[model samples]
Target: MWELFLTGVDAVMSVQIMILIVLGVAVGIVFGAVPGLTAVMAIALCLPLTYALGPAAGLSLLVALFVGATSGALISAILLKIPGTPSSVATTFDGGPMMEKGEGVKALGAGVVFSFLGTIASIIALMTIAPLLAKVALRFGPHEYFAIAVFSLTLIATLSTGSMVKGLFAGTLGFAFATVGIAPVDAIRRFTFDEPNLNSGFDMLVVLIGIFAISEVIKVAESVRSGKNAAIGSVSMKSIKGFGFSMKEFFGQIPNATRSALIGIGIGILPGIGAGTSNIVSYIVAKKRSKYPEKFGTGVLDGVVASETANNAGIGGAMIPLLTLGIPGDAVTAILLGGFMIHGIQPGPMLFISQGALVYTIFVALIVSAVLMLLLEFYGLRIFIKLLAVPKHILLPIILVLCVVGAFGLSSRVFDVWTILLFGLIGYGFVKGGIPPAPFIIGFILGPMAETNLRRGLMLSDGNFVGFLTNPISGAFLLLAVLSVAWHVVGSLRARKNASTELAQA
Candidate 1:
């Protein structure tokens, strides 16, 4: 195993492989830091480019994109008071405050460092644990898969920042959208709107880009309308020193970071929840356990660390299911499915046995990509911070063009372009109505998989609904989902009661 790892490391260090890793990280960071562009969009648009590269090269491209994109989210989260990715939304909890306080460089530095460490830690864990985990995942049948999906869907409350009703609606819409296309089991089609495109349902990436990116453009336009072009805060290494590693601070946060990473990896390795939801899970736990919870949104490094680390850890965690079981843990991994297929490789058990070397190579590449992320963010911090000055009017127009290009670029067809525009309007409406967008993307991405598995599970049990609870793993997940909802409902009630009590006392 040691020799194989060394071999993989040697292979990753080759000039071509190294160049691809750097190039992919650079591209992903740029895409991820920008509101309208995303890591999935970057990889999806670049899938064609990978066709000419070797297996290791292609894996390097995708993994580097994943690593860089997850971390790059913090750039916009800090500088723009907008999350570059859903995963970075939590960063805005404190990151925006830091940026507003002119400590933007320190926040960026803290985020970049922790994000790199998270990636490195998760990559090491993935390399060590995937083979063992694969053996266990092999035991999952359709019912278990259904259970996992349920467990993942329960995260909607966790993902929703302000309102549960809106989050549920977004999540439900996603599940409903998944019901589009031909049914996975009986091949029956539902909700196609009789349009051929609807037959395949909405592409989650399109939905993600539309919801986060397109809605952002509309929001930016409004900000510009208000004549709000907050001066770009200057970022520098000198200003970043305050956030440097400290033993006391490090010990205090070790548990939070570790637990958050574990949470992120677990959610990320799940089939549907993905990093978008995973980061928030980490942040909530970190904040809940924080010695100074009230200090979380107050421009603190701990908040930045908790979020940035978990999201990066999620990248490595999401890869486990994709590489081991051919099950994509998220939309980004789903696109990676295409990348692997383009290289004539299958992603199941055989992937490990037949392509062990390549898997190891990808793992090595992720570690290298993590290092590159740190280096780039540390030195190029000013470039992203400067985005704050481009004037909202100019940036919004560029965003509009980029959205069109990104969507159309997926298929080189105008149909996808229109899809982006339509969804963009939907996203804008969702935001305007105070709806949370995270669950919608989650639902869209998991829709087909959930639908297919639901049908398969039914068929396996001759359409017996009770079969869902007959299996231990499936039963456990179902119980957890129910308990999760119950917990949230109770917590909401208590918080309301407490607020009322305080109001009465006052």
Candidate 2:
């Protein structure tokens, strides 16, 4: 253990690697501070570049990017009404209102502090539990994996913030997209359209850019004439320092942070729900548990802390399944798993025992990334907040061009360019219809995992309807999905009844 720690420490101590880690954090903060851009897209853009570096450096870059991007999201959520990522959705509840109330610095400080703590807690949890979890996960065969995947997708669709029908449609579209080019089972070409470039389906990064970055461009263009989408406030050093809630008030919110972190981590370890949905869930949980629940949605720090802490901690929660079982728990980890492949490391129980040193290095890397994110975000606020000052007219076009370049660079194919535009339009349609994009992205990312597993599980059981229930692992996941759906339904009904009562009194 001491030897592994020293080796990992040595790797981090290299000047070049430290520079790279810091660079990744800077880039991630910028990406994350922008609405409609996310950690998945940032990591994807950086992946091609990482292909040239050593395992430690490459992993450091990607992990730093992930940590920075995830943490960076609170910036936009606070300053702008929209969250930079789904994970920041809860942050927006308090953050946007607080910014409106001219308390941007307070919201930002609380968010950053809690986000750091949440991340640290998650890493500690990972250090302790990932190995044991992986050993149990290794017992899962293809059938169980497929079942688990199916359960995850179903839970996502049911839990997503819109009509179940639309969620299902999105999942179907994603599953259909996954089926294109070639069959995963037999290398059978299915929907290649004979264009020769479609044989690999969609590169994850290309899809990410399309669904996120390009979609934002399209939305921005649609609003170009109206000019109603102006940013609400700017982040300044003054804003950062003035974010004072009493230390006592912050201490009082400790339960909110801890509970939200646990919830975020719990939801994260579960497949399909994704960070976006987790934030929404955490926000609701915090509001419900707060002594002054009425303060929720009224520019309170508790809301910001709840959302930021959970979503950030989620990075750790999601890694549990990915590192231990080789099954990606979410989109970012799915991409991180790609990094593991490039290093010729297979994840599972064997990964824990065989690559103990590397595993610890990766764990240590998460801690390093968090520290770097903290330092850069605090000291470098002036540099990043300046981005919001860029006129939308100039910034929009540049981002559009970057989106185009990013999409094309995914596989160096024109088809992906078309794919980006197509998804951009689809995403625009959703926005126009008030369908939240978070669930759609979650559904799309989880589609393949869900589809493949369900098919495999059913085939393994000879089409027995009871198969999911017969397997303990599959049964547990399916059960959770059922309970989640039921709980949401009950909650919604109660909310509607309360609203009706308030209207009657008015």
Query: How far off is residue 452 in model 2, in Å?
Result: 5.5
Model 2 agreement with the true structure over 257-290: per-residue lDDT tens digits: 8998888888888765657767778899988887
After superposing candidate 1 on the true structure, give the runs of residues whose Cα lies further than 4 Å from its correct spot: 1-11, 31-56, 73-111, 157-159, 197-199, 235-311, 321-358, 385-388, 395-402, 409-412, 503-506
CA error at residue 89 for candidate 1, angstroms: 6.6
Worst 10 residues of 1 by lDDT: 228-237
After superposition, candidate 2 runs with Cα above 4 Å error: 1-6, 80-82, 92-104, 228-250, 274-288, 291-300, 326-331, 334-350, 353-355, 403-411, 429-469, 475-506
State the C-alpha lDDT per candidate: 0.76, 0.76
Predicted candidate 1 versus true structure: per-residue lDDT over 408-496, tens digit per residue = 65557787777777777888888789886666766665556666778899999998989999899999988988887788788889999
Query: What's the distance in Å from true for residue 387, model 1?
Result: 4.8
What TM-score against the true fold does each predicted structure earn?
0.78, 0.82
Backbone clashes in model 2: 4
